[model samples]
Target: MARKSGKMRSFNVAVVGLSGTEKDKGQAGVGKSCLCNRFMAALADDYSIDHISVLSQTDFSGRVVNNDHFLYWGEVTKTSEDGIEFLFQVIEQTEFIDDATFQPFKGSKMEPYAKRCSATKITSAEKLMYICKNQLGIEREYEQKLLPDGKISIDGFLCVFDVSSVPSRTIEKQVEAVLTILNNLIKTKKPIVLVTTKNDDANETYVKEAEKLVGRKEYKGAIMLVETSAHENINVDVAFIVLAQLIDRSRGRARVLPFIEAARVR
Candidate 1:
């Protein structure tokens, strides 16, 4: 999708926890700082995605976007809400291309094939706009769904997992919950790419447990586990390439390498 043309300084993507090496000792899962760092590294190239600013939980001096939403990770506080909300705030502030110009694919490729389904045929991108607004709790208007540029509709969400740091028990439960969420969100048979970040910080035991979790899931075939690091500037590009593939797929362009390729592995 094209970017909106305007004099707006820049879009805001709050990499809440990904900008530093710090971690809350009490938290059990992957560190927010690490995740934010990796996420930013992966998405920085996209003109649509921007790192506006980070608001630390300890010190929140009103760095919220558009004076409404606060981008945050870790735990919810008065300063910020939740991880999902943090993402939505960024989306709300960003602008997309002309909302009226999108040409919905009309070919048979847009038809149901095998298990996958097609995009919405409704001329208006209302359904997606509603989900993005309400599901993420952006607190925007029911009518203000479309941005000035009109491309707020998201085809699907790509969840990047840091399996190596997730506790075994928590990992199992989170995986199940994620699968359920994805199954529901993609009810139209949309694709949800669940890619795993490469974690050298995790020990062998954690890796084994993550592999086991991957094995137990029905979506195992599409899961990709990468061992990369943003600090080292590791296979970060691969994630964006995968994201590009997803964008192409959304446009009815099928990719030959359906599986994780060797280049992205190392």
Candidate 2:
């Protein structure tokens, strides 16, 4: 049995999102960039982040290269034991658009017709799933087999999706995929935090869909809904602090003494 009493256990979390301009001019949206920036800021006290690596097609190699944010330790090479081990740890702290895929540059481009690239129609969820399966050695079919390593099994997953960029044709399925992943993950009895990556009212539809999914089903794990935006620094701190508390509680670690209210600052 994994010892679930270590308040001192350090965690290496990866906040995967888009970077670079719509067509690779190296400009990212305020919402996507801020989501991660704020998350790091909030966790700076309890945990130390190495560097925020901007993950893209160019940096997916199995090399420990320095990056502006965290060290961009490219894709996990199957041939290298060290690479696999490092990626496995990252997978543990990862919070992405979808529980299954990562495509960091899909929506960053201003217009799809611009660069005239291969034009791969990849959704945020599919992109993230690709990273997990190809880079992290985690496949949906084999996740169960990969579990039982004596670790707390991801403690929980917090997926932040910027629904505004979702394409019209596949939006419904994209949303459904998230619900499915959440339902499956909750079975582990770990807390799942579904965060809206944008604060605009335009995203209310997406938030509502997520809420419906959680409320319609009786999940074994705790579910939380938060609206996060990095530019204005809206609920970034609130989301992270909330997750930290959830993580602490789930691991059966520290608990606030009686009558000491857990501060809920907006």
Each prediction's TM-score versus the true structure: 0.41, 0.46
lDDT of candidates 1 onward, in order? 0.33, 0.37
lDDT of 1 by residue, 155-179 (tens): 3334444545543334554455444
lDDT of 2 by residue, 24-129 (tens): 2122232433455444443434222232234544433222111112221112211111121112222212211211243333334333221211111211211221
Q: Which regions in candidate 2 have their CA more than 4 angstroms from the true location?
A: 1-7, 11-34, 41-58, 62-153, 163-170, 250-266
TM accuracy, model 2: 0.46
The alpha-carbon deviation from the true structure for residue 163 of candidate 2, after best TM-score superposition, in angstroms, is 4.3
Give me the runs in candidate 1 sitting further than 4 Å from their true place: 1-151, 165-169, 212-217, 249-266
Candidate 2 backbone overlaps, count: 18
Error of 1 at 253 (Å): 11
lDDT of 1 at 214: 43
Q: After superposition, how far is residue 251 of candidate 1 from its true place, in Å?
A: 10
